[model samples]
Target chain A: MRVDYRPRRVSSAIAVLAAAGSVAALATVSEQYLAVGISLAGVLVLAFGAAVYRRGLRVLGVPIALVGVAVGFAGFGVGVSLVGVYDRSFTYTGELIGLLGLPFIALGVLPVHRRLSRRLVSLGFAFLVLGVVFTGAVNGTGPDPIPLLLGIVAAIVAWDAGEQAINLGDQLGSDARTWPAELSHSGGTAVFGGLSVGTGLVMFNADITGLPLESLLLLLGAALVLMVALYK
Target chain B: MSNATADTTTKARATNTDAATDADAATDAEVETATSSSYGQRVSTDADGDDLVVEGERRRTGRWRGIVAVALFASAVGVLANTPFLLLATVPVAAYAAYPRLTGSPSATLAVERVIDDDTPDRGDDVEVTVRITNTGRWPLTDVRFVDGVPPMLAVREGSPRHATFLWPGTTTEFSYTVGAEYGRHQFDPVTALLRDVSGGTELEAEVDCDPATVLTCTDAVPEVPLRKQTRHSTGRLVTDDGGAGIEFHRTREYQKGDPMSRIDWKRYAKTGQLTTVEFREERAATIVLLVDARPSAYRASAEGEPHGLAYNLAGAEQLLTALGETRDYVGLAAIGREFCWLAAGVGLEHELTARELLATHPVLSTVPPDEDPTDPDEQAAELRKRLSGDAQVVLLSPLGDEYITSLALSLEASGHPVTVVSPDVTSDATVGSRLAGVDRENRISSLRQAEIPVVDWTVDEPLGTTIVNSTEVMD
Candidate 1:
């Protein structure tokens, strides 16, 4: 009945490895899309692990979300860096990653407390929406673009650092071995299972992702309940 | 031994050591100890009635880590079915189930000990009682209450039971209460204690026999006015004629002035030289008898403020025994209501001491010996009827409510046994406003008056001196 508030253990080594894997997954998947979205499942697993394990969430959430946004942005940051052979489409620096999308993933699910994480994530989401609105207003690029882009980079870095700090916090406990596992699992879910799924669905449905968000989310939720009821 | 308040420290240590050992030895099987049975199973009967007891249930698991299981499931589902936030709603629901946070094991002993500071009490006298509850188990006691069974013969109201919030293994909690007492030797059969477990869903019961101890001591109603003259052959300050040594004259005789200075009769010498000074002697009572009662009805229950006649009568018996015992007089005892209860009369403090001890130690209901001489009653009546062989004084100890005793008192008077009725007050009905008690009182007093037996009605409130001073027979 009494909450054991004592600091718990953390696995620093596992956390670093999880963060590296999440970023690497997003980078490789961005360049090499497999159409079926099986890589999306990997992202989801990492996200779910982060959310469930206290330390895992803190370690993996920011890195995975930031990496996904970074991958999306890398395609946009360079002009004509990628020209699809299928349609000879022009890939612009801001268009592919969508200057604002990465910010949402980086900032949304990384805070220690749920409310703060939600607020920060929502604000980032709002910025992304603004980017779309601004892009439509200016017909593509804003007046002061570098600072805005740097601001995007700064936001992602801040979120990643915050996630690392929370997951590796002395406050959660000095238990080195337990913390990394807790942070990686919990942080990974808050992002991949939590935010990444939102981004992936939103992108898929909103032409931003070229897929359906609600239907995809519904299928995932239903599948979840069935899997647990059957397997667990 | 470690002086820990509730044996918690000892239990903690034992739990650390014993549980580890047990866990290693019986890793697969759960062991149930001797203290596992609940209190309801400990009930047993005694002379008074069935002793009361206390009892409860318990159950333990590794389900605490299951809280995180939701996330892993949520993730797999999110990828397969495409939903991500489904688990957010199930967050708070994951904290259910009963889990033991207890660190150690408790000892297997639950003991109940009751100590009556004083078992014998005078009516309206305060007596202290203590009940100690000990938990020998290593577990912490959540809630516990102890109840003491008081005999109905004693006028006791339900007092607050003591609570031992925590009784660790090898630890005890002693609870005490101050209770007012009435006369008579009341018995304490068994002590009952109920204890609860950490979860409070289970309980424990324990009952232990505690030897009876006196709580309220009702001494004889002490007489206020000191008697100036001691009874003949009775031990006291009174001077008597049949004595071994005396400063007073028993006879007068003619004597010469030349006799020893101490023996010379100065008045006789001045008048006629015939030294005829009277010789003085000390007086003493020949025999003294104390009559007590042990009839089944004599031990009937009475009111709270006013006890039954038996308690008062016993109190009076105590006083008379003390007074007579002090004078070094031959004292005899008789229980009027029951079978032959008279003890052979003897002299000195030892005799009265024996009688006092007999009354003090006697229970309300004493079984009549089957071996009594078949003719002792009639023979005793005949013996009482014989003249008091020269100034034997008799102290009749009674509630003065029995009719048969009054007739016996008259016969004793006729037999020349000078009798003093020393009654202990059983006067709840003296005012008549009390209807039920009044009828019983009226019948009792009438029987004494018609028989011409001197009666002393003792009231609990008034001192014994008032009864003696108000007696018309004693003044005469």
Candidate 2:
């Protein structure tokens, strides 16, 4: 509860963004049969949100655009990466999340006001982080997927917060002036992922120090996330 | 406020043609330009009895003209070429045609406000010029150009009219220029731009509609040196001051019986009216031909980060005439660079106006090369000296730049005319180069002093006015 609001916000934004990216990548993993619908939904949602930011109106259009685009690639990359590891239905979940994620991003861009946006942003952040922690507990440390998930979430928070706060002075957008918020809610994905892997390694293996490996990897992820959000 | 601004800009371009027509050759030049859309509407507006707003814009006209020309040409070429590429070109053509209607300078969006004009500069003073421009446009701009226009007579070759800046939408930029002062008018010309496309093909030319009639004027004041310094006479000014009436103390003359009671210096009369009353010597100055020596040898060192010494002398002379313009003094400005520069002295507003016109003006070719045995003013002054002797004062503003001119100053002083040498001294103990230059400057300075001429040894480091006030106070 006492955790810095800005950091938490960054963590949440990054978590959501990372989750969406993961979902986007996984959308096609459902293989051709299930991939199309989920991918299309995600891309359509994203584009519609951007459209709204540009033209101002119609939140639904972005989801439609995100779905079309995300699905258009159709489970190809995901199928190649995951093979048969994940259940095909995961793509549907990924699709649904991306769809939901689009509106939040658009709203983030457009600003629906404090009460609604804050609740949704915070709640979403909690779910992703919890999911990462739970995954880490189950999995043996080092390279645990849970920390990876959390890092993505943290990255999203950093970028979204930047978009929300900075107008770049010359344009209508103001997320972060030059850097992502120090709190880096979006970085939550990287943190959760790192912690999960780190703790899992400690829990399972006694010889290696989870602290160094987890910290180093997570630090690397955090740096990468900050660059993505700020360099542009 | 927006409406007021638009209206003012419109009015500036809409000067009365008839009034302009009656003006002299100067007005003739204006009349020729008056026919342009930028002007000539004042007479029509008054004649029509129409109270309609004068609508005009800086960018709109340019855009529309280009758009119209391009659209018509593109359409014709599209039909003639009958190719898909030409058809593709049609999109750019259409964009051009639509741009004038859709994209504009958004007079209301961007702003050119809070214009602050410095006090009128004398002929020689350097005045600060500041202009603030804001971007009220929708897009981000990488470069903005600000052009500050002065009267044609004052245009010099060395400076630029534009200073570059960047402005994002809603961001403001301020531009400034510092140039030597001259006479006549200096106006704020409308802003213009060549905006590059994101794709980098077509350039969007935008011009802001603004008032160009804004006038900046400066007069000259008489050169104030010490009492020992003599004044030189020029054919340009009429120097004799008769007893019309003035404030400066004149002289004690035999008292006439019916002299006005007011003419009697009460304090002096109280002591001795029987002896006579004080007649304020008719306070007047001769037309002073300012002959500045601007050769390479005459070049003097300036304080760090400042212009050369000769520049200060030039500015000083201009200011003197501008101040003198305020009084009854007639002042003419002359300079001896490679060639002798001359300004005829005149009276009242005309004299001040002429000096201002000259100070801000620079000769197209400033250097007097050694090979070119140019006609020096000292030689010319010698000829004019005999006729104008006992009449005009010659104020020479120089870096004392060279030896020949230094001797020229002495010779002029020896010629029975009061001469004031304004030396924008370039020598300094502070300069390493000066240390090696061997009191060359000191010797020249002393030589001018030996002639018993009043010398205003000005440094670019300190203001000429400080030296002037100090020197003149001793004389007074």
Candidate 3:
């Protein structure tokens, strides 16, 4: 009775797809060849780490994937020197390469740790928020909101799907036939992401130029309501 | 050994095409509850039969915590930075956080039926267990996860017992796994279902009983168990000290006038003037009692998947019964466990069947270890001694894992009943604790042997018959 608790195939597929989509969207918005190259290298390292993990060195593989994340972040720092930090495109590139590392970090922690802790997922999510804050630091009319918005949604989906995959892995193990549950969860997240993008696009196009405070307060109130709903 | 017949009455009816259509028609009138109003309540109160038992409260699995944190963080950052895009992304994350509250806990109206390929398998044979789960509720169960309760004695050889899947109403799902069977009667436990609502947020735990209550009975043909030299007065095979009319010669004496002609020593009469009568050893039946030590300590095993020491003890006890049954000897069975089990010394076909059934199904000789210490060993010994016939020899089957059993054997031998010990060795050098336990057990066996008890030190890896034969030679 060998117990193998590796994440299922479908959820992992959805995670990688969502992560790659996020990186591609950010790279295209940034319009930098260096951003694409750095993101590709990060993804390749992540793939290598995943292969190593599949070979049964589960403990060793997580650190290797985490190293890949470190390399991606380090690559972004080095790119900032060559590409210039003040420009809006440089910030987008930084955000792109940084966001590219999120899924691997999620993948690295999920199967190996086997606890119900949310630290790893939260860490990746925090990185997404930090990237958005960094992009806003440049503040040059929000860098064509559509791709940026889609990139954010995709990153969130990637983390959510990764967490769900690991949850299934803990409960059922990798050998169980968990495709239906995994696919259903991923499908629900994708649908919500699509609807969010649609609603976000509509709001962007509405073009109400005044009353920014009211809008901000309204968003904060909605967030407070959601939090209360969850706790209740 | 026999297969317990699968009870077809407990099997859920397979929904046919007509039934599916009727269910579909009934679906429209039954307001679709894929939403928040039915979140906490059991959806199918109308479901009859009450086979599935749902227990425990709605436990929050904390699966949505990360997503909710992300939603809150994104909203806070977006509001402060005035970035509408990041704020917009919060909408979807918030939706996911709310998804759990918007869904109802599945009815958990699942019918679980298990079918064993071979209910009465031979020792060490692979037995396949197929489990079929059918959703009899109206709503589709989106995130159904369960792990079948495999018998503790059997180890799974192929496939996994854990499964997660979605089941639509009237649909059935099946999964099968193989387990290597061991000696004894093993009953499968109920399947544990961890049912989560459509969103993996809220979970309801339940136990689902399988139809037929699958039980695997694996038994071996009785092996030869050699007894001590003690014997009863009845005529049988064991040679006793008293000289009488038998095949083996004992001595010669002066012939009496009334002695039968066949008993007279003709050769001695021809050699000498004085006539002598030849005396032979008397053969008589021995009454034997097989006592199994099934205390908690005897439930130890050398390895994780190996059968425990008590299992070996029960096997040895069964062998002794069958072997003694073949002779004219009166044989009985007894065990010291959670309960004291005893059968009076008897010799008949019906008695043998009763003894065998007791070995197979007695709670005292259960395959699983008792949670608490059994009743006092002294009390059980007194009860056993009271029941044993005066001339009956006791064959004690024990693992000799602890001091109490060794003391018990010595006490029985100290009494009028001659005792022979068959100790099954389940010790290994796998860990420091196991090694120490092995040393302790070795000391116990040596101390028992010091009391002049004929002990068969049977290593579990080999057949008990060979060990008994080897020990019998040593005893002789």
Chain A only: list TM-scores of all candidates: 0.29, 0.39, 0.74
- Residue B142 lDDT, candidate 2, scale 0-100: 43
Fraction of true contacts retained by every candidate, in order, equals 0.00, 0.00, 0.46
lDDT of each: 0.42, 0.44, 0.70
> How does chain B score by TM in each prediction?
0.53, 0.50, 0.69
Can you give the lDDT of residue B387 in candidate 1?
Answer: 28
**Candidates by DockQ, descending order:** 3, 2, 1
Candidate 3 chain A TM-score vs. reference chain A:
0.74
- Model 1 spans with C-alpha error above 4 angstroms: A1-232, B1-126, B133-175, B181-212, B215-236, B239-264, B300-305, B347-353, B363-392, B425-452, B469-476
- Give the CAPRI rating of model 3: acceptable
**Per-residue lDDT of candidate 3, residues B1-476 (tens digit):** 11110111111121001111233434323323311232212233343225335454668877776666767777777667776666665666677677777776666678777778888998788998888888987888888888987775578899988888888998988888899876655667678888887667788888876433456777655456676778888888888888887889998888878888898888877888678888899898888888899888889888875778887887777667767778899987788878778877889877776676666555677676888867787888888888888898889888888888888888888887888888889899999999999999888878878988888999876667778888888887
Native-to-model Cα distance after best TM-score fit, residue B241 in candidate 1, in Å? 7.4
CA lDDT of A204 in candidate 1?
A: 37
What is residue A115's positional error in candidate 1, in angstroms? 63
TM-score of each: 0.39, 0.38, 0.70
lDDT of 2 by residue, B1-476 (tens): 22322322233323322211233565445444534543212122122211111223333222123223333343344334332222222233333233324322322234443243454677656555555556655775543434444333233333334444445677766655455565434433344443422111223444443322334555433344332223333221222344434566656677788876777667766676464666653434554566665565554444442345555555566556555565544555565555544555557664454444444434412221345555555665554454443546677777765577677777766766567877766666676777554377667777777777778776544556677887667545
lDDT of 1 at B320: 62
iRMS per model in Å: 17.8, 26.4, 2.6
